[model samples]
Target: MPRYDFRCRECGSTFEVSRTMNAASDPARCPDGHDDTVKLLSTVAVGGRGAAPASGGGCCGGGCCGG
Candidate 1:
């Protein structure tokens, strides 16, 4: 299950809910029992090492300068 963030416009409180992707658009009630809420756009964090830089004899390292 994925967690989604929602903000309650009635009480001005933020909350989270865990549900399936199919019901991601479903309305969520805040902890304060506020039904008027809107889902917030969340950011995903990716973890992993970046790709190694290209190696070559050129200004851009990829032989762009005809090295």
Candidate 2:
């Protein structure tokens, strides 16, 4: 079972859950017994587009090969 992140809307508590993919369709309530928990997206998504270069400066000592 893969783990997914969830956040409790009532208390703003983040948690991890392990269950089958189908379980994500109807998630369980928070341990506090409130049905205000919502699944959070992957960290990669929060970082936004990631196709950018690794470094702003060239890697080959500015030799123009990478500069």
Q: Which one wins on TM-score? A: 1
Q: Once superposed on the true structure, which residue ranges of model 2 sit more than 4 Å away at CA?
A: 44-67
- Report the Cα lDDT for candidate 2: 0.76
Per-residue CA lDDT of model 2 for 1-67, tens digit only, reads 8788888999888888888888875675787777888998886544447665555566554567642
Per-residue CA lDDT of candidate 1, range 24-57, in tens? 9999988988889999998877656785655876
TM-scores for all candidates?
A: 0.68, 0.56
lDDT of 1: 0.88
Q: List residue ranges in candidate 1 displaced over 4 A.
A: 50-67
- Residue pair clashes in candidate 2: none
What local lDDT does model 2 show for residue 41?
A: 85
Best by lDDT: 1
